[model samples]
Target: MSIKGKVAVVTGSAQGIGRGIALRLAQDGADICLVDMQIEKLQGVAEEIRKLGRKACAFQCDVTNRSQVFEAVDYAEKELGGFDIIVNNAGICITKPLEKISEEECERIFKINVFGVLWGIQAAAAKLKANKKKGKIISARSIAGHTAWAMLGMYSSTKFAVRGLTQAAAQELAPFGINVNSYCPGIVDTNMWTEIDHGCAPEKGVATGETWKASVAGIALGRAEKPEDVAAFVSYLAGPDSDYMTGQSVLIDGGIVYN
Candidate 1:
């Protein structure tokens, strides 16, 4: 699919799945702007995009911060000419029982996962609306968004919120030919899983990457999902081919969630 003239802004793209998606979109011909909290790593990803022979820019944006996201979005619009696509890939996760979860932790998780998506949507809404032309807004809604997890409730809360956001935004944006939707990635084999595994493992007291691999053994697919796996789906969502799809959340899990 050729996204040749489309300008794409991807958040949390400094590494892992976000990085994969950003690069994949660039490869598909979209001019790419990478957003992340880590400047150095963001630069690294930008370098890689350049190597791919695509236009690239990196913005140090903490999506949870409204001003930062807005400024970055404006800057990107200025630098890239205009906004056409937005991939709200920035988010955070925290594993804790509802009762045991501290206020600070819960707030932090919601701020990043829930509010982050909202902020991105709000900032882009005007620009996307003004175009009244074809546009794409894709957010990262995880498999956890569709189901409950024993200790992942705090994190799951945000994914569910993203789902709601996608549905609502799609309904509102469709009039302008801008599609709004989300994609759920099931138990992706990103650094996130490693951290979750080690943190949850009581065997080694703290996982040393040795026992981490077994954390996802219960998955039906027998392996964790790859970053590219999710990226492929994201590419389709951001491409012209998926114009008919809106306000939907498609899972990229390896059968992790059959429903």
Candidate 2:
């Protein structure tokens, strides 16, 4: 499972699951290109990767921007000397009922969650094909993607779209030896989950913390998901062990929404 001497680009790597994935990849001996709009936090993650004895570069990028996504890949290949894996982990979650989801909100989340992954697939495939290298393209999905939940219909829709993109891109890029897959997480103990809990609190008529507790109540593992849990799976996806796998939107949510 070693990815030693490979180079990887991880988007939204400034915090949470992205940060965990970047660090895990570095720990597995892959040089990293950390991409995010949060420049300072990206630098911090880069420094941590450096401490792990892996080359790291911090590149600020808006994943929703097609050109910026392409440039980020270019920068990664140039700075890290190769591009073997791309983890399109940058995404935003919106909590709103389907009935009340406005046009603007729908567009915003779709741009970040759907279009961002699309551009990532495009950029990564292009680079890998040009270099004649086999690689992996991973993206972030959610449990909502597998089964739609209340107040997260629109968010779920975008994730489902990501699953579609992953499958289609996998087939299209298979000829080039590029694999496309996604990770589906649930109830992660991250700022994003905190935001989701808060958003559900008002509708559920409960306090913020209570909503989060209610959510964790359904987990078979009896605990909230962690960044490391997801990172561990992503490390496999980015390594040789998963080379035979593609177009899979795997659920790493402690047995939640099992498929």
Candidate 3:
């Protein structure tokens, strides 16, 4: 599973699951390019990767922008000496009843969660092909993608869109030896979950923490997910061990939403 001396670009790497993936890849012997709008926090992650004895570069980027996404890939290859992996992990979660979903809210979530991944795929694929190298393109999906929750309908739709993109891109890029896949996480203990919990609380007529607790109770693993749990699976996808695996929207959500 060694990815030693490889270069990887991880978006939304300033915190949460993205940060975990970036650090794990570095610890496993890959130089990293940390991409996020949070420049200060991104630099902090870069410092941590450097401490792990891996080269790291922090690039401020808005993944929703096609031009910026392309630029980031180019910058990563130039600074890190090569590009072999890309994790399109930047996304926003929206919680609302289907009828209550406004057009603007729908667009906002899709732009970040869906279009961002598409742009990352395009940019990474173009770069890899230009360099005549094969690479991995990973994106963030969710258990909601597999099983659409009522209050999270919009967010679920975006994730489902990502799954479609992953499958299609995998087929299209396979001829070039490029693999494209997505990771589906469930009830992670991150700020995103905090938002989900709070958003569901009002609809459930319960306190914020209660919604979160109830959701976790359904997990067969009997615990809320940690960033490292998702990171571990992502590490496999980013490494050579998963070279033969592509077009998979894998659920790393304990035992929930089994496909």
Candidate 4:
């Protein structure tokens, strides 16, 4: 599982799951390229990684902007000498029932969660192919991706698209020794979940904590998930041991979703 000399480009890495992944990879000896629209927080994460004795750089990237994503990837590869992994962890969600889902919301979710992933795969895969290097491309999917969730129609739809894209990329890139996969998480105790809890409260006529408690009840592990929990799984996917596993949406959901 050693990746001492590797470089990883992680999008949406200013906070939460993306930030955790970048720090974990850096702790594991990989140089990190942190990408996010929030340059201040992104640079903070880079500093944290640098403090861990790893080479790290922060790039201001809006994943929805294809050119920005490519430019960030190119800059990382150039600065780090090569790219070994790219984690497409930039995504968003809105709390709206099917009846309330709007075209604008649908388009925005797809742009970040789906199109963003595709753009990262295309950019990173091309770089690896041109260098004849085998690498890993990991993305963020969700439990809603596998099974539709009530009040999250648009988000679920976009994540489902992510699952398909990851698989297709895996199949196409296997010949070139590139691995593509995604981490599907559930009830992670992140800011995103906090937003979800608050957003669903009014709709469900419940207290804020009620929504979070109900979600945690379904997790057989009997606890909320952590960002580090997802990061540990991503670390595995980025390492040599997981080289044989590709095109798979591996769930790290504390048993909320079973395969």
Candidate 1, residues 1-259, lDDT tens digits: the string is 5798678999999888999999999889888889999989989998998898888888898888998887877877888888888899988777556777898997898898888888888777777776665788889988889997766888888899888999998888788788888999987877787766665666346546644466467677788788898999999999878988989999888777766
List the lowest-lDDT window of 10 residues for candidate 4: 100-109
Please, what are the lDDT tens digits per residue for candidate 2 over residues 5-53? 9999999999999999999999999999999999999999999999999
Candidate 4 lDDT over 2-115, as tens digits, reads 989899999999999999999999999999999999999998998999999999998998899998988988999889888989999998889888898778888888899999
Instruction: State residue 52's C-alpha deviation in candidate 3, in Å.
Output: 0.5
lDDT of each: 0.84, 0.93, 0.94, 0.93
Candidate 1 lDDT (Cα, 0 to 1):
0.84
Give the winner by lDDT. 3
Q: Which segments of candidate 3 are over 4 A away from where they belong?
A: none
Task: Flag regions of model 4 displaced more than 4 Å.
Answer: none
The residue ranges of model 1 lying beyond 4 angstroms of the native Cα positions read 203-215
Clash pairs detected, candidate 3: none
Q: Candidate 3 residues 166-231, lDDT tens each?
A: 999999999999999999999899999899989999988999799889889999989999999999
Error of 3 at 146 (Å): 0.3
List per-candidate RMSD values in Å. 1.9, 0.8, 0.8, 0.8
